[model samples]
Target: MKQLFDSVRVGRHALRNRLVMAPMTRSRAQFDGTPGDLAATYYAQRASVGLIVTEGTQPCADGQGYLTTPGIYTDAHVAGWKRVVDAVHAKGGRLFIQLMHAGRMSHPDNTPHHRAGVAPSAIAPGSGMFTAKGMQDIPVPRALSTEEVRATVADFAHAARRAIEAGADGVEIHGANAYLVQQFLAPSANVRTDEYGGSIENRARFAIEVATAIAKEIGADRTAIRLSPGMALWGIDEGEQGPALYRYLVTALDKLGLAYLHIAHQGDEALLADIRARWTGTLMVNRAGRAREQVGADVASGVADLESYGAMVLANPDFVERIKTDAPMNEPRREGFFGGTAQFYTDYPTLG
Candidate 1:
């Protein structure tokens, strides 16, 4: 059995352990899309983890879906993240920046340009997004032209390059949740008749292209992607063939030689098993609400090479130390999970 504290190799980096710090959206970036100053301290505080996947970051200006979320597209954005990268590296941590585009799950007020959102089709996600004013209904997004789709693919590649320039160990394409990539994956959200939609291959095309482009920009050994098979959040429904779609998608992506496949498991044990069987590389599994006692269960069973934790790592700065010593963890406060000062963000005390 692989213990949670055991050292592991993920892609081109040698991780200290098999515990990964999962990506979470913390609305702490500057209005200009730069990361908060304390972002470095916040991430460095949790550097004891084997791998640290930074918060969801927009790849372009229009990719913004929530106010104060970080971006990696601008020179200022790169400078801001460089500090975070240096901080984590000083603490001997490996970090991966998660590149995300919110798609139709966005509000005009949330973006600086106040432009209409873009997706495979001009469909509304039928959900609300957090804006400066408040939670606002998502508007109908404009359909991306085939050329624009190609351009957006380039944007992801550029972002990956920028992340590496900023000193990040790697980049993780956010193909999960209700983000842009998954928006294209979901049938209900992507009703286009173009080569990027309709059939399973079409729906999966955008994701595959984004991953391929990133891997090309940065080495495949430093490129990874996080996926949520059958995720239906914010009006995203992959339909009845969701399982088959993932099986096909995972198989295709696996051949790309990506560093790792981080799956935010949505409770399909059978499908997860199938994915484990198809993927020959490193697998990072994030089982929602996974208990402390089950931390290394997947790794022990050979189902996953690593396990990712969001809230647990957020509340426990000494998460790796605590797990190794069997110490009690501080409960994460929900109210402080989003935007806030160091009060809850980096003030979580570690065992002294």
Candidate 2:
């Protein structure tokens, strides 16, 4: 069995282990989309992990979906993230900022400029989002014109550059969940008849362009992307063609020579196998709710180069150490999962 403690390399960084810290939204940033003050401490405390993929950070103003979620577009945003990158690097960790654009999964009130959400089509996600006041129904977003779509792609590239400037080892384009990139990938969320919609190639164009642009801005070695093959969250349906779409998309992305393809597997072993076969680059798998005993099963099975964990890493700062020693882990406080202080963020006890 390939142990989780084994060291690995992804892109340009040499990781200490095969355990990755998956990106997760904590909603603890400043109201202006700057990462919270404790962000440095929070990430640094978990630096023992092989790789840290930070929360979904917006690439542009219209990308803001949740309250206090960070962004990398502004000067302040870059400066704020520098502290986080410095802190993580100081502890001998590699960090990747996950660049996210929320698309139709957003509310005007949640954004810094209160701008309307944008998507490939003007559709509502049929979901409610948490705002400053309370949970509010998501509104129909304006469909991005071909020009706007190009601009959005540029925005991702710019954000990736900013993340690099902030001292991050790399950036992970958030092509998963029900975000903008996935909005384009899912037929239900995309009803456009333009070049960016309709056929599978057209639907996959936006994500490819975003990734290409980021790779060009930085190096292909420092560019990575996260994808969820058939996530139905927020009313997104990739259709029965979902599996095929991913096969085509992954093949195209694989040729780009990206750092790694992080797949948030949603229980489709066949599809996962297909993606693994199609992709030649490094592969990282995030299987939510996997038991403690099965932590490194994917790596051991040769299906994944790295295995990512969220709640376990969130609740246990010394998660890698705990796994090595078979030590008891602190339970994650569900109530303090979002918009909280150090109580649950940086205060997670490490095995001492």
Candidate 3:
């Protein structure tokens, strides 16, 4: 059986263990979208993990969603993230910034300029987003023109470069979670007939272009992508074409020869096995909401190169040690999961 402590090579970085800290949105950045001081300490605490994927950070102003999320397109943002990178690096950890474009899942009140959300099509996500005025129904987003779409791709490339400048090991395009890339992939959210919409090939085009551009900017080995196949979250559904869409999408991305492909497995072992076969490079699997006892099974069976945990790592700074010795885990505070300060963000205790 493959052991969780076995060393693994994920692209250009050599990991000491097979434990990964999954990218999670904690909404702890400044209102201007810059990472705050406590952010560095929070990430540094969990540096024992082989790999740490930072929370979903907006690649551009229009990409902002929810309250106080961080960004990577500005100088201030870069400097803020640099602190975080330094902290994690000092503790002997590798960090990858997850560049996430919220698309239509954004609210104007959540951003500095209070800009309207942008999407492939002028469709609403059929949900509410937390804003300055509290939770409000998402509005119909303005459709991006062909030129604007190219600009958005450039934004992702720019953010990837900034992440590298901020001392990150690599970058992971957040193509899942009903965000911009996933919005285009889902038929219900994307109603455009242009090159960026319609057919599966077209829907997957944006994500491919973004990934290719980022890879070109900072080598293919330093680029990665996170995808949640068959996930029907936040009223974003791909309908009857979900499985085929991901199969086609994953196969296309596989040829890029980028870094590891992080998969948020949603209870589909057979499909995951199929994905593992389809994808040739390293694979990081996260069984969302799985019990602690089942965490290492994916790695043990050779189904995944690494395993990631969210709530476990969120509550336990010394997650790897806790897992290694079967120590007690701190219960995650639901209320402090978002829009919180040090209490839930950086105060999680380490094994003494």
Candidate 4:
């Protein structure tokens, strides 16, 4: 039986355990999309986990959606991430920077360029986001031209190269949570008539192309993606075709021999079973609101090769140690979850 604490080969790196610190956006980067000064300390503090997936990092200027989210495409961004990578590595932790394009889930006031966000279609997410000015409605994004779509794929590949240059163990494509990649998979968000949209295969083309490009640029063993099938957030509705689309999408993505596939599941046991059966590589599952007793259940039951925790690890810097001792966990403070100083970022006490 595979225990949660067992060592495993995830990609080019061998992890110390199976506990993963799932990527959580702390919105603490500088105005230039560079990671904040405390980022190194914050991540290094939680380096006890087997893997630490960084927050949703934009790949390019246009990819920026939220205020102060880090990017991976520039020299300063690379330098910022290098410090973070080194901090995590020095503590014996592996890290994968998550490349996220927020798509229509953005506002002009939040980005540096102050331009409308880009997406597969000219549609709004029917929601608002926090900005410098305050809460504002997300505007209808400028639809990407078919040619622009291909260029965007190149942008992901370039970012992957930059991440590797920064000494990261790998990069995870943020294809979940109604981001650009998931926006393309969602028919309601994507209404393109070009080769990039309409049917399931066409809608999945951008993700496959982006993954293929990144896998080619970096090694496939260093590339991974996260998906949230049937996730109905911010006006994203995959509809009844959700399961079918994922079946086809996973089958195609599995052929790439990527490092692993992370799924932010949403109560679809049948589909989850199907995904587990079809996926041949490592699988990581993040169950929202999972109790302490269920920490190692996924791995023990063979549902997932690795189990990820977000809030638990976020609030408890020594999450792995606490789990081992069955010690009480610190409650996550909601107020300091985003764009804050080190009060809640790094002040979490650990077992002595």
Candidate 5:
């Protein structure tokens, strides 16, 4: 199992270890959607991890669904992210920017222009989102026209280019959680009878297109995607077709030869193994809320090429060291998980 800590090739990059810092939403960017100064320091501090995936950053203004989330569309956003990438690189860390587009999970109050949200269909998600006025029921989002859908995919391609220009090692398309891409994949949220809905192939089309566009813009070697199969979070229900939908989606994406496929492990060991059998490239698995003792099991068992950690990495900047030496980890502060200063973001102590 010690081999799990050894270096391995993932896509075009050779990581020094199999530990990865998972993308986490800290809500610490500027109100203008630019990454703040502390963001660089925060990421740089955790450079010990083999790879660091930055918090979910919107690809465009309308793509933002939460307050203070970063964007990659503007020159300013690129410049801000450049600082972060430079810092991480300086510390000998490889970084990937997770390009996320929040769909109907948005409130106009959270965005700068206060624009209404957009999704595959005009659905409200039947949930509440955090806004300046506190949590409010999400409004029914505007359904993107077929042309707009293509435009959105182009936006992802543009963001991937911008992320490369900003010095990131790669870009991870956020197709997980209850975000824009997942909304389209979930039957409960997407009721469109158009070409983008109805069948598993149709529902998976948007994600496939976005991934293909980004992979084309950058090489497939510099593109990655994250998926959460069987996820039922925030009113997202992919229904009985969830498993089959993911199987088709994974198989289709496998043909693209993306940098890696990051999966948020959702039980079902056999299904996870099935996905691994189908996908031929690097795989990174994140077992959400997993115990510290179980950290490297996925990599050790060959279920994944790398293992990703969220809160543990958040509270323990020296997570790699902690794992190696079996050191105690600082408990993550729930209050500072979202909007906060450097206290929970970067002030965690490393073992002396």
Candidate 6:
């Protein structure tokens, strides 16, 4: 059985252990999308993990959904991230910048130029997003032309190049949650008859193209993606065909020979098993709200090559150490989680 502490190879890097710091949204970046000044210190503090997947960063300006999320498409964004990459590497850690496009999950008030959100279709998520004006209902987004769809894929590719320029080990395409990529996958969110919509193949095309473009710009070994099958969020309903869509998507993604497939499992054992069987690359699994006792269960069972942690790792800087010693952990401060100062960001205690 593989242990959680076992060393493994992911992409071109040989990781020290199988514990990955999952990508999370901290909402602490500058309003213009540069990473917060404390970003370096905060990430370097948790460098003990096998890999540190940075927060969901936008590939372009239009990709920003929530307030103060980072973007990688600009020189300012790249410069800001260089400090973060240097800090993590100084601590002997590997980092991947997760490129996320919010699509219709956005509000005009939260983005630059106050432009409308763009997606595969003009449909609204039927949800509200927190802006400077407080929570506002998300408006229907502008539908991208087929040409614009291709341009969006280029945006992801451009961001991947910029991530490497900022000294990141690689980039992970955020194809999960109810974000742009997931919006395309969700029938409720995507209703176009273009090549990017209609059938399972069409809907999966956008994600596959984005991944392929990134892999081409950067090496396939340095490219990765995260997916959450059957995630019902922000009025997203994959319908009964959701399971089939994932099976087709995973099988197709496997051929690219990218670094790894990270799955944010949504409680379908049968689908999870099917995904595991179909994907032959390094697989990282994140079980949200996973308990302490079940920490290494997936690794021990050979179900996942790596296990990712979010809140526990966020609250405990010495998460790997505490796991090794079976020590008590600190509770995550909910108040300081987003758009905050150092209180809950970099002040988490470590075992002496």
Estimate the TM-score of every prediction.
0.99, 0.99, 0.98, 0.99, 0.98, 0.99
lDDT of each: 0.93, 0.94, 0.91, 0.95, 0.92, 0.95
Write down the lDDT that model 5 would get: 0.92
Pick by lDDT: which candidate is best? 6
Residue ranges of candidate 2 with Cα displaced over 4 Å = none
TM-score quality measure for candidate 5? 0.98
Collision pairs in model 5:
none
Q: After superposition, how far is residue 340 of candidate 6 from its true place, in Å?
A: 1.4
Residue lDDT tens for model 1, 248-317: 9999999999999999999999999999999999999999999999988999999999999999999999
Give one digit per residue, the lDDT tens place, for model 2 in 222-326. Answer: 999999998999989999999999999999999999999999999999999999999998999999899999988999999999999999999999999899889
Question: RMSD in angstroms, candidate 1?
Answer: 0.8
Candidate 4 has its poorest 10 consecutive residues by lDDT at 4-13
For model 5, the stretches where C-alpha displacement exceeds 4 angstroms are none
Off by over 4 Å in 4: none
How many Å off is the CA of 139 in candidate 4? Answer: 0.5
What lDDT tens digits, residue by residue, belong to model 4 across residues 1-352? 9997899899788999999999999999999999999999999999989999999999988898888999999999999999999999999999999999998888898888999999999999999999988899999999999999999999999999999999999999999999999999999999999998899999999999999999999999999999998899998988788899999999999999999999999999999999999999999999999999899999999999999999999999999999999999999999999988998899999998
Give lDDT for model 2: 0.94
Candidate 4 or 5, higher lDDT? 4
Better of 3 and 5 by lDDT: 5
- Model 3 Cα displacement at 212 (Å)? 0.4
lDDT of 4: 0.95
Clashing pairs in 6: none
What number of clashing residue pairs does each candidate have, in the order they appear?
0, 0, 0, 0, 0, 0
Q: Per-residue lDDT of 182-223 in model 5, one digit per residue for the tens?
A: 999999988888889999999999999999999999999999
